[model samples]
Target: MLRMEILKLIRNNVVALIIAYILAMSIGINILSFGFDELAWVERWLPILTIFYVVILIDLLFWMAAMQISEDMETNMIQVMRTSRNVIQYFFSKHVLLLLFILVAAFLGIIPMADQFGFVLNFLYVTLVFSVVMIASGVLLAMIVKKQSVVMLAGSVVTGFIFAVMVRLVFPLWNISPIPFNPFEAFIKAYYYLYLPVEPPNQSYVALTLIAVLFYIISLYVFKKLTFDRGFRL
Candidate 1:
C-alpha cells in the first residue's frame, strides 16, 4: 500500500508543487522580508517567515490529504481494494506519506535561512510536531469531507482558525502568559536560542506539543471510522 502510494506521489504533480512552494517561499519571502525595516536586526524575520506564508503550505497539505482519500472515494478504487486489503492501513499509508513530505519540505525550506542560523534541530522538532498536527488535521478533514475541492476549502478554514488562535492573532489582548496549542508559531524560538544566543522561555512549545498529541488521537479515531457508505456521494 505504501509503495503504491509513493508511486502515485512520484507520478503526480504534488512533488513538483512542493518544490515550487519551497522555492517560491524562499525567494518571495526574502523580498517581502526586506519591506520591513531592520527585519533581521530586530530579529523579526522568523515570525514573518512562519505566520505570513504558512497558510499557503497548509492549503497544499490539506489539498494533498484530501486528494489522496477523496479521489479514492470518488472512484471505485477504495471499494475494490477493501475486499483484499485493510483499507484503514491504506489510509494510514497516506498519513505516513504526508509526514515524510512535510519533514523534507520543511528541512529544505530552511536552507536559505540556515546560512545565518545554520541548521537547528529544534526547527526540525517544531516542524515534526507541526507536520504531525497538520497530517492529523488533514486526515480528520478528509474523513469528514467527501469531495476534494470541498475538503480543501474546509480544511483551510479549520486550520486557519487554529493558526489564528495559536499565535494569539485571535486575541492579542488576551494577556496570556502562555499561548494556546500551536506548532507553526514556534519557528522563531526554535532557532533563536541556538543561533542568536537569545534564550527562549519555551512555554509555547510545551503547550503546543500537548495539543499535537490530542489532535493525533482524535484524527486516528475518526479515520478508523471512515467509510465510503458513510460518505456516499453521487
Candidate 2:
C-alpha cells in the first residue's frame, strides 16, 4: 500500500519532480564553483554547506510540496480521501515519499563534489539530515495552507526565516570562538548548534536531525486531527 501510494505521487507529479532535480543540481554546481573560489580554504566549507541547505534543499522542497500536494487539494482529491480512507496514512505517506525523493536528489548533487569536500559518507549524512528538516517543514506547511499560491508563498517565507536564523544569526555567533576552524571542528560545532547548519564541527547536522524529528511528530499529530470535509474545503 505504501509503495502504491508513493508510485501514485511520482506518476502524478512527474513534471515538477523533473524540474526540481534540474534546478537543484544546476544551482548546486554553480554555487560550488563560484563560492569556493571566493572564500579562503578555511572558510569555504561552511558557506558551501549553508548555501546547499538554505538556498537549495530548503527552498526546493517547499516549492515541490506546494506544486505537487497543492494541486491535489485544488482538484478536491484530498477532500474525498478524508471521507473514505485513513487520512493519517495519506498524510504520512506523502511525507515519506517526499523525504525519499529528497534523499536521492541530494545524493545526485553531492556525490560529484565529494572528493573536493571530503568523504562521501559525511557529506551524505549532512545532506540527509538537512533534507529531512526541509521535508518536515514543507509537509507541516502543506497541512495548513490548502491553496497552491498561498502554500507556495507561506512556505517560502517560513523557510526563509528558518534559514535566516540558522545561517545569518546562529551560525555566525557560534563560529566566533578563537579556536581554529577545521572540517572536523566545523562538524563538531554544527553538532552543538544543531538548530543552525552554519556552525562548525557539523554539530548543526545533529541539530537539523533532531529538529526534523520533532517537527515530523508535530506534523503527524496535526494531520491526524485535521477533519477533511466531503466537499471542496480548505
Candidate 3:
C-alpha cells in the first residue's frame, strides 16, 4: 500500500512538482546572491530562505494532503483501505510519504548554499521538525474539509496568518537577546549564530522540539476523530 501510494504520487506528477519548485527556488536564490560577499549573501538570504521554506514547503504539503485525501474520498478507496488496514497506520503512511518529499526538497534547496554556508545541520533539523508540524496540520485540514478547493483556500489563509503573526508580532516580542521565546525567532537566531561565533541556547532546540511534538499530538487526535467519529466523511 505504501508503495502504491508513492507510485501514485509520482504518477500524479506531485514528485516532479516538488522537485522543480525546490530546485527553482534554490537556483534563483543562488543566482541572486552571486556577486555579494559569501557571508553577507548568506546573512541576507537566510531570512528569505526561512520565509520561502515556511510558506512554499507548507503549501506543498497542503496541496498534497488535499489532493490525496480528496481522491481517496471521491473514489471511496479510503473506506476499502481502512477495512483491511489499521486506519492510523494508513494515515501515518501518508505522513511518511510527505516526509520523504520534504527530505528531498530540503536537500535540493540547501545543497546550493551548503558550500557557502558550510552545511548547517541546524537548518536541516529545524526544517524537518517544521515539516512534521506542517504535514500534520495539512492532513488534519484535508480530513476536516474533505474538499480540495476549500482545503487549499483555508490552508493558504491559515499559513499566511501564521507567517504574519510570527514575523510581525510573535518574533518581535519573543526574539530577546540570549533567550528567544518563539521557535520561529529561534530559527532565525540559530541560523545567524551558525555563521557568527555566538552559540545558540539549548533551550531553543528543546522548545521547538516540544512544540512540534504538541502539534503532532493534536494532529493525531484530529485524525482519530475524523477516522472514528466522522467515518472519514466527505
TM-score of predicted structure 1: 0.67
The TM-score measured for candidate 2 stands at 0.60
Query: lDDT scores for all predictions?
Result: 0.61, 0.54, 0.63
What digit string (tens of lDDT, one per residue) describes model 1 on residues 1-234? Answer: 688778878776766877677778766655554454455643555544553354446447666877777777776664546542554556677777877777666655555455555354566666666667776767767767768668746866656654554455424587645445544555434433444445545656677678788888777666655553344332
For all candidates, the clash counts are: 0, 20, 0
Candidate 1 clash pair list: none
- Position 91, candidate 2: lDDT: 56
The alpha-carbon RMSD values of the candidates against the true structure, listed in the order shown, are 5.3, 7.3, 4.8
Candidate 3 least-lDDT 10 residues: 176-185
- Global lDDT for candidate 2? 0.54
Per-residue accuracy of model 3 over 50-165 as CA lDDT, tens digit each: 45654467557757866777667767665656663555666666778877777666666555457755445666776667677676667677777777657667776656544653
Ordered list by lDDT, greatest first: 3, 1, 2
lDDT of 2 by residue, 1-234 (tens): 457556556666544566575566656654665566556752445444544443455456666655555666667575547543655555566656766766666555544455655444555565556555566566567667766678757865655554444454345756644333221233223423433345344234556567657766775566546634333244
Model 2: residues with Cα > 4 Å off, grouped in runs: 1-50, 53-55, 76-84, 113-118, 162-207, 228-234
lDDT: the better of candidates 1 and 2: 1
